[model samples]
Target: MLIDAHCHLDFPDFDADREAVIERARVAGVVRFVVPGTTRERWPTVLALGERDDVSVCLGLHPYFMETHRDADTEALARALDAHPDVVAVGECGIDARFAETLGAQWSLFDAQLRLAKERELPVVIHCVRANDQLAKRLRQLALPAGGLIHAFAGSPEQARKFLDLGFVVGLGGAATHERAKRLQRAVKSLPDDGYVLETDSPDMPLAGHRGERNEPARVAEVCRVVAALRGQAVERVAEASTTTATRLFGG
Candidate 1:
């Protein structure tokens, strides 16, 4: 079985046939999913989804939606984590340099989440984009006891190693399947057996041949195939390694 280490199954895109989507993923050998909450307004839906035996949940404020988050949201997140012992991690949080205007605020929010994770001894599920170096620096200084997963990682092999060295794992997904993503593919090829996990980042990051359509957990099987080909390993091996790493980072 495989786990979609990161997927937004709570998004409205799947509201039409959510169960069908999950069934398809299970049929395709993707047995579990990690769903992360992006905002306070969405936490109810995110938490509700966690009721499933096959779904794990995480809560945090995403940098992309900085304008909607208030200063008290971090404290709210702490309470949410306390109230929900089933939450597997403390994230969907990290710095996204693409949003230049909210970069500073993003750092503050991300830092707060990191500290919360440390205090709770829970791992994190990060959403890094164009700020791998900066994020890595913060992670190193904090040295979270439970470590974390850098979801949908698209950095170089060297950068991947930095996270691994800091007791974290990089997540590989649809981005690594594109033929033009030579750099990311190289990073995938160089990853150590235990240094990476698989994710679909569903409702976004559609795979290569399915670019215009909505992505889903079912497609993570294709991601495994591509990653196996990239690393010159068997598909089953990639699936097992990634699932193992994901399970270790975010318990069932």
Candidate 2:
């Protein structure tokens, strides 16, 4: 069974047939899922989805959603984490330099989430973008005890190595599907299979051929094939390594 290391089943895109999407993923060798909450507004939705036996969930405010975040959201997330023991990880939260203004707020909230995760002894799920260097530096400063997942990792080999050294699992997904993504493909190929996990970032990041189309968990099989080809391993080998890695990282 494979693990969709990061996704948003709570998004409205799946509202009409979320169960069916999950069922299709299950049939396609995806036995476990890891969905990350984007904001306090969606914590309930994210946690609620994890009520199912098949899904494992994490909570955090996404950098991209900084505009929607209020200071109280941090307190609310803490309460939610305490109330829901099933919340296994701390984030899809981290710095996103892609937006300079919100970058400040994102770090403010991201640091708080990291502290909460450290306090709770739960792993983290990072949503780093154009800020891996700073993210790595801050994570080092905070010294998080419970490592995490760097979702949809599209960073340099050096960045991947940094996160892996910090006991993080480099999340691979549809972002690596593009033929012209030679750098990402090379990084994926070079990354140690033991420190890597598979994902689809479903309802987003559709593969090259499927660009402009909605991505789904079931389509992760195509991503698996892409990873397999990059690693020069059989698809089953990719699946086995990723599944084992996911089980170890999330204990699913």
Candidate 3:
């Protein structure tokens, strides 16, 4: 079975047919999903989704939607973590250099979640975009006892190595399925067997042929196939390694 290491199954995109979606993914060999929280308001819905046997959840504020966050949301997150013993990690949180306007607030918010994760000894699921160096520095500053996953990772082998040294597993997803993503494909080819995991980031990062359409967990099977081909390994081997790594990092 494959683990979709970063998906938003709780998001409205799947609400109309969530169970059917999950079932379809199950039949397609995507047996589990790790859904990360995007806002304080969505935490309850995300928590509800986690009640499922096949789902794990991470709670955090995302950088892309900075305008939706309030100062009290961090406290709310801590409360949610305390109220939900099953919470697997502390984030979908990290820097996003693409949004220069929210950079400062993003730093503070990301730091708060990082600190909470450290205090709780939980792993994190980072959402970095064009901010790898800054993120690497912050990770060093607030070291986590349980390392994390860099979701939807698209970087050089050297950049990935930096995250690995800091005890993180990079997530490979639909982005790697494209013919033109040579750099990411090359990075996947060179990644240490245990230093990466598989994800779909469904309802978002659609694969090569599915652009402009809603991505789904079932598509992670295609992601697994592509990654295995990129790494010159059997699909089963990739599934086994990614599942083992996912269990190690997130423990679902």
After superposition, candidate 2 runs with Cα above 4 Å error:
none
Best-fitting candidate, scored by lDDT: 1
Give TM per candidate: 0.99, 0.97, 0.98
lDDT of 3 by residue, 1-252 (tens): 899999999899998999899999999998889999999889889988988898999999999889999999999999989988899999899888999988999999998999999999999999999988878888888778999999999988888988999999999998899899888888999898899999999899999999899999999889999999999999999999999999999995
User: Which rank order by lDDT, best down to worst?
Assistant: 1, 3, 2
**Against the true structure, candidate 3 has what lDDT?**
0.91
Q: Which ten residues in a row have the lowest lDDT in candidate 3?
A: 134-143
Candidate 2 residue lDDT tens string, 159-209: 888988888878888889988888888789888879799998889988989
Tell me how far the alpha carbon of residue 136 in candidate 1 is from the true structure, in angstroms, after superposition. Answer: 0.9
Candidate 1 off by > 4 Å? none
Candidate 3 runs further than 4 Å off: none
Window of ten residues with lowest summed lDDT in model 1: 243-252
lDDT of 1: 0.93
